[model samples]
Target: MYGRMNNNIYILLFCIVFLISIITFTTIRIITDKEREFKKLPNLKAWKYISILIIVAITSFYGVEIYKSATNYGGKLAWFIERLKNERSVKFEHNNIYEFGVEGIFEDINKEHPLPKKLYMASDFDLTFNSDGIITAFDTFVYGKNAHGKEETYLIAYDKKKSQDITIIRNGYANPDYDDDKLVEPLIKTVNAIPVKQTVSKWNESKYGLVYYGKRNWGYNTEGIININEDGKEHNLEKSTSEIIGYTVSIFVPGKEKEVVPARYNLIGDPNWSKANTNPNQKSSKEKQQDLTNSKEQFYLSKEVGYKLNITDKALGSTFYSLSKTIDGGKTWEVINNDPFNGTIGSASGITFLNDKLGFLVAVRPSGTEGELYRTDDGGISFKKVNYTPREVKLDSGQSISPFDSPGMPYEKDGVFNMLVGQGSDGDYNGNSSALYQSKDKGETWEYVKEVKSS
Candidate 1:
């Protein structure tokens, strides 16, 4: 960027120099030409001298101002060029982003950024809030798949003043696609991250912790010159061409943690697909046959999905909300009003485990006019509609420009499901602002709340 600016300066200077040279040469030539004719009218010499003086003065002033501004711009441009070049040399290889703790007030990221951005999943992670309800940290989860088909898990972190300093906690490569089945889809294959408690402590115990750093002005909050290694490239996290990653999702349910990942999402063809293998569509046989086989044998099961006892409410799209049930360590998702809710709660933008019982899902309403949030009571199988927008909105990425319609949901409390929702068919659905909405009675209603934002 700096180099580009420098080139512009040079171009401007060249134009100025060219014009000045032409004028100076033209003025001298005119004087010489006039001299030939002036012998007949000598009084014109005074006019000639006056014209020469005026031209010299004007060009000299122009040259001075141009030189000063150009030199100043050139120096600044040099500094920026140096910084950018250095950034490239020590890029994504550095992973010491967490060195800077929470440093300033968590600003509204939606003001400038496109929600659900490609760099990270827009509104799926939990917001780490301070004791005062102010957001202190930001986080999201994501599934990383390499070209060789090795899947890896990661936790991306954000904080006020230094949100991009992510920390990679638990990482492990996944099994090979023995079937070479790129087309196989799963019932639940992704995860939604929820933030719990976070440390506001400083790096190196050096008085530079979030508490140590005064609020607002964050000049001293140096997370350090960490390299922005995105997708193996040394680039700035803010302006990288990396894929959007929110939270690390796994069908790896807490209770079903021990179960191995199956080959396909649907056991449809698998004879074990029906615990009531005799007839899954039959109502009487469903009750008559006590299928003792693993639930995986009957239907699609994934650690990536939130489980419940019974689900009635649903969201639109390709998911089946009533299919999975998570009983042991997680929340109970017993849902009601299935007739009112249609569609599945699978592969949506954000999903969070609020405590062990309450949960949030960002999905489209049946009418599809606005985005909505769904709540689970027992675990899975049913859901209740909450007055929440479905996804985040964004107007533009440049100049921090955003329209009212572009309200977005970007981040949330740790471990809590956060999402962005608003009106319109956004150019990039993820870029819309996903600022959060708060509801007390299980999303029956909602109210204004702090929005997730960047530094």
Candidate 2:
């Protein structure tokens, strides 16, 4: 399929080049003819007509390609076109108004907007609030086409306090792509009388909630306070036109303006913020290692000894994990084996140890409906695939089925090791059930127990 698509792209490119060459050739001939005899050429009119047709053909081909790439089979285009037709479309509006409250501000700023015609996604909204928990300013983008039909963003800033009607403080193509490098020092350098908090509004009901940085109590200084000296000249945050400031976001419910809590904050001098400035849009090595350590699957045999499986790499729908042993209560860890499943491709579902010398590891395939079970007896130094005994269970239609799809980690219950092999997402009987297995000789082999139904 992809090869055919690549061939089509090559054909399109050739057609574009051919059409452009004709256009260029005709244009140069028409311009360079000193005696103007080019206009009297026998096929001059015919060539002109052919040039127009070629231009239209090229345009139509480009339009078709753009549509296919943007809509991915016409699923997104209809709704987006409808949004563009609406009068209140956020796409063209320069200013927006909301009620004088937190919920209203949040709803208006974070409301769903039409997919941008040119940009990657919808416009982002930033809100600024005063110390009294009142939203004082906000900024959002309006998109429109230039004379050339190329879309561009109009970044607008508004002030809410100057009037019940929102006041437009600034509007321009100053930061069309919202690139931080284009920021300039504001011309009006007034210290905000009221302490302010700035936050990016939550969009699309994000599960992660609103994102902000800074000290909750420090509050953001509207004027740049931090200063940097370079080349015998001192530049402060405000002087350099740095928008960076520590600010806190407040959480509030409707009709309860007085009941607000400082939910999250980002401070300028905070350790994370400083690291971000040094690294700029990427995690530091230490931070990445810490994240990997935090996500590691661990099985502890005692307070002082444990085993952990850390994901090392993932490629082509397969995840690789590195097994490590930790002594002295996880103070330090040494990698025991890099390939626990011997190059098997899947996700590490669970890892557990029965003793200092016996352990089990479960890996689920990318399909989620199948997995592999492995056992290690030499303290996780090596592992070998273990097979569970499959059992047949009667379905709702009185049909007997054996589901050996997903195998879970082994756990000791009532002095016996029990494991559950699940049917995963492909189960049609008992709503994707599991088959329980038991091991009496410490996870070396398994015996069929019974089918467990999904709750």
Candidate 3:
């Protein structure tokens, strides 16, 4: 870039010099011709002086132009040019630039696991491939919320050796539980190398609780420089960073609609159905379901999957919520569960699904019991309670809240789930959460990714 700028400066100076020479010569010739016509050399010296003055003025004008051009070319233009050049280089050898055949591997993955038809499945992957162009693993960051309804980050790792994928929530760089058949050491190193914490930090910084860095928005935090080797040694990567003011989303266009749509949202309040459930005589099951459904009737439609949640008082005055998903728009809904509590001594708070069959639910008791997590593999036919402890929501006022309320529905992208856990007095869906948790094993187990402050 500097070299090109220098060349331009030289060319501009040459043009200025050439123009000045012509102007000076023209002025002198005019004066001389007038003198010859008059047949007298009257004030020839003064005319010469005038010609010199004219040349000086012309030179000064061109000199200013040259300086201005240099300034623009070096300041804004230079940065733009360098960025463009780098981008072009990346595009030209995009497949091999990041790593040999990185693009090809992505293309293959997309072709092999095309987005699910009749379902809004935006399959966006954050991937790291081996040197041989074999995809070793990938990650998906959830901006909105997970099955548990908290906005957090989850990780789904693919081990080539095992030919299987496993999800896990990060606990401050702690390694996830790997299956016995897979090699844990390499997968651990790869997961650790990814800037999962940094990505979550960006999401927390966003007012809308999101971090999507890619080629969709005019190079806004799109590209990076990194090295990949077999040793698993830490490589310093220079990433382009952006301070996104709010959460923005675009479904990885494929299955149904080839468009990137922003995730629509609404805030939920304290369980109003508590009274209806507490007094079964007050409201019938249908009435209670309608009430719960009416409150959360608004749904956000991604590519193929549409998510809607209803919190109602169904059992013993406890909170009962159902997570309904529609694959064919609003025409039909395949719910994970009709009654989230299911005789358990807790209230359903949040829900999220990684796919059709695998899903998760969050529940808490009104009697100050710790939050409990449940998972279902057969599309919510039945859920098994998982033994997991949750972190308490520490308020700014030095008070603590438990059984995290998922104001924002849990967001699931790829195979990862993100949820925010917090308690608020206002009873509205505000992101004033104490912590964010990520789960890869369909919410069966979650690890603390980070603490998120209310935005």
Candidate 4:
């Protein structure tokens, strides 16, 4: 809507200029008619009509614009006029950070704002909070047109406790004629210039309290370099290709004001540090191989007692399964059985334990059309495949089909073990509804109850 208004304004100005030019030329020609060539002139009546139409069009466009300004902008005529003069717009975005153990007005420039050709706009607002939800660090950028109408990009970093603001000129064309000594800082930090699409924050249980990570392209042209200005001296550092193509992780720990290190520093030696420091989205060759060869799934029956299924040795599209028990809150694990599914060749979809000695493990084939259900009576020490009894289900379309192609783990509800069996991708009857089966005798045998729709 705003774009259409701007276009209309431009068109209205053009028409007004055209009408003025036509009127001025006609009047001059009539006054200098020395040869009495007024009768040979173009249709003056038509020109007068054209001029009236242009005037009416301009007036109508202004009337519509004024109405819109009154309705949308609370009748702020000066504000609307200023927006027209600058040919720019501003938008606000607010983010809720309560899930990150912090609550504040995390408002910043909307990412949908038009990119400035000469100026750098404030694209993102990043905050680092402590364990108690106290904001310790803030990172953002400031941008606007200078007195000479040139754009300026200033990277800003604020320390909450120190109450100091660190600003750095990002773009090469930024004016440095002002007092640079006051802007010089002992601690210079790099900030993201591009708009951040997604941000992930993790609680570092080691040294750092909370770590905020932001993902964006850090190529040579996009990477933000910390250009420190000391004693009114500014330096523009060039980006190198060796810079890792990964996300930037900001580590902020309370009470360590001066120890804010770069994301490249693996101070905590987290296992995922190497992966995130390299390429976060892409997995390495070794990691991919490991993913294909090995997998683990855990199900906790209680706060301290849990069971884990480890599928390993992927050969010939099959893998060996083992069940491990952890009684002391995952501190130690004990492998009870080497082969729970009697050497089944499928992926373990789920593992559920009703008690310490009774559990079920489900293994689904790669096609997901069929699966093997194993039940253990002696706490995963031994296992035997349980064949589920199939029942015909009548669909709304009057078609009867067995919908128990893939069986899920049994969950105890209302003193009964209930399980849902899906029809997999091959079945599309009744919106791919699952057949709910209930076991009355502790999952010893199952009976068909009813059809359950996939929500």
Return whichever of 2 and 4 wins on TM-score: 2
Error of 1 at 191 (Å): 27
TM-score of candidate 1 versus the correct structure, residues matched by position: 0.25
Off by over 4 Å in 2: 1-296, 394-400
Residues 394-446, candidate 1: write the lDDT tens digits: 43563332322322332345533334445433323334334455555544555
Q: Tell me which residue pairs clash in candidate 2.
A: 185-241, 213-265, 213-266, 213-267, 214-265, 214-266, 214-267, 224-238
* Reference-based lDDT, residue 404, model 2: 64
Stretches of candidate 3 exceeding 4 Å from the true structure? 1-316, 319-328, 332-338, 345-348, 364-372, 392-409, 412-416, 424-433
Please say which candidate is ahead in lDDT: 3 or 4: 4
Alpha carbon lDDT of each predicted model: 0.33, 0.50, 0.40, 0.51
Lowest summed lDDT across 10 adjacent residues in model 2 is found at 185-194
* RMSD value for candidate 3: 24.6
Clashes of each: 83, 8, 22, 0
Worst 10 residues of 1 by lDDT: 211-220
lDDT of 1 at 130: 38
- Give lDDT tens digits, candidate 4, residues 1-455: 33356656987789799889979987887788835656664556887899799889977987887677644223456334533533222221122232322212212322433223333322234456444434555554335555667655444344557543222323311212232111211111122221111211342422233332322223333223322222222233354433233223343444453444233211112222222224445656754432222212567777568887764343222345677887865546788888787876545767888888898888765334667677888988998787778878676789887767778888898999898988754667778888888998888888889889889
In candidate 4, how many clashes are counted? 0
> After TM-score superposition, what is the CA distance of residue 238 in candidate 3 from its true location, in Å?
60
- Order the candidates by TM-score, highest first — what do you get? 2, 4, 3, 1
Per-residue lDDT tens digits for candidate 3, residues 238-270, read 443431111112212122222232221111121
Sort by lDDT, best first.
4, 2, 3, 1
